[model samples]
Target: MRLEQKYTALLGDVQRRAIGGGVPSAIGQLRLCFEALGLASAIDADCATRLGRHGLSEGKFVLLSLLRDVPEGLSPHALAERAGVTRGTITGLLDGLERDGFLARHADQVDRRKLLVRLSPKGEAAASTLVDEHAQWIASLFADFTPAEMQLLSALLEKAWRKTDRGAA
Candidate 1:
């Protein structure tokens, strides 16, 4: 079924089940619907499935994407901060990536205790290929949207992001 039809059905159900009389409560429920829809879209898009078929986890994909522009590599601490993860989580991601030969860790010249993580040539190529594919998928997914509609949606989402607990990106 079309997404709009699904949304309409769900909204009708929500309105029927709504307990409060005020418009504010109804608006709050609608906001929750938007959140649910966003999550459902993400999962249904199956970005993770595509990445997995390429032997890449979401964590690895994120790391590779971040490392693509930095030939010099980034430190674990920096990567963790940028990725909004803990150092331990970074270690886990690095371990898998290293085992897959997609990335390598080198001793920091200035600090022997520190390790600099960089993507291998294979990893770089993979990153480029995966990024292109993902972009194409996203473009196709939104093919029905007009340029103006996309711009407006982007602006609205950006506004919501700015208000989120994570703050602006």
Candidate 2:
């Protein structure tokens, strides 16, 4: 069966199981969903807080992180792809970063039609500081997890992500 059909059947089974268990109401399921969303939002907020000190929002930080790995910088299209954001959004982000002296956009030397983005001196300094802080913050977040538990969690997350990507493809 197609993945969608399999997913739909799985969902139906879950609903049936829930109903058979004398679940109080749909509200319980809604609450669970909300709680999951809350956790995700909180994680994102924490990252944003850490990034904000270096004049970067979560999205901007993601973009800069992508750029940091490529000294020559990436074209806007490639940056958007790596950042998992829209072209327009990347454009606006680049504009904001440039205005704040974090990055600069210039025509590619070999291809004038393509714009290349690079971090300015100020931006590189900010990025280095933010990267260090982010590493510490991430380490703290998982401080409670044992090495085995962390490995297991990472594997599970990667598996789930691969499954999701396959379905999307």
Predicted structure with the largest TM-score when compared to the true one: 1
Task: Give the TM-scores of the predictions, in the order they appear.
Answer: 0.72, 0.70
Query: Residue-wise lDDT of candidate 2 within 57-100, one digit each (tens)?
Result: 98888777777757788888999988888999999999999999
Q: What pairs collide in candidate 2? A: none
Candidate 1 lDDT over 1-169, as tens digits, reads 2345666676666666665543334746565656657666776559888898988887888899999889889999999999889989999999999999889999988989988999999999998888788779868877999999999988987776687788654
Off by over 4 Å in 1: 1-45, 156-169
Candidate 2: worst-modelled 10 consecutive residues by lDDT = 1-10
Candidate 1, residue 138: Cα displacement in angstroms equals 1.9
Judging by lDDT against the true structure, name the best candidate.
1
Residue 103 miss distance in model 1 (angstroms)? 0.6
For residue 169, model 2's alpha carbon misses the true position, in angstroms, by: 7.5
